[model samples]
Target: MQANIGTIDRALRVVAGILLIALSLFGVIGLWGWIGVVPLATGLFSFCPAYRLLGLSTCKRCQ
Candidate 1:
């Protein structure tokens, strides 16, 4: 899939994802922390299914 997520958004997602995972690992949060995988995967893959469904594209070069 094309990258509909921009650089800043991707970075934020990655950071948030990592933070959530870390929190879970450290027992600062519960199983919900696993949800971080969503953002992490989307950030790493540069694609978000929800964004596609919403018809949003933040990519600098989208065709």
Candidate 2:
């Protein structure tokens, strides 16, 4: 799939994902922290199925 996520969006996702996973590892959060993987994967792939389904794109070119 084409990259629908922009640089800033991807960076934020990566950061948020890392923080969530770190909190989980440190026992600061419950298993829900594992949910961070979703953002991490989408960030790396630069494609969000939800965004597609909603007809949204963050990439400048895509717009």
Candidate 3:
């Protein structure tokens, strides 16, 4: 899939994802923190299925 996430968006997602996973691992959150995997995956790949479905893209290049 094409990259639909912008640089800043990707960076935020990565940071947020890492924080969530870290919190989960540290027992600060819960198993639900594992959901961070979704953001991590989408960030790393620079693609978002939801954005695709909504016909939206944060990447200026993609637009």
Q: What is the C-alpha lDDT of each candidate?
A: 0.91, 0.91, 0.95
Select the stronger candidate by lDDT from 1 and 2: 2
For model 2, the stretches where C-alpha displacement exceeds 4 angstroms are: none
Give one digit per residue, the lDDT tens place, for model 3 in 1-63.
Answer: 889999999999999999999999999999999999999999999999999999999999888
Q: How would you encode candidate 2's per-residue C-alpha lDDT over 1-63 as one tens digit per residue?
A: 988998899999998999999999999998899999999999999999999999989989777
Is candidate 1 or 3 superior in lDDT? 3
Off by over 4 Å in 1: none
What TM-scores do the predictions have?
0.93, 0.93, 0.96
Candidate 2 vs 3: which has more TM-score: 3
Q: What TM-score does structure 3 among the candidates reach?
A: 0.96
- Cα-based lDDT at residue 20, candidate 2: 95
Position 62, candidate 2: lDDT = 73
For model 2, the local distance difference test gives: 0.91
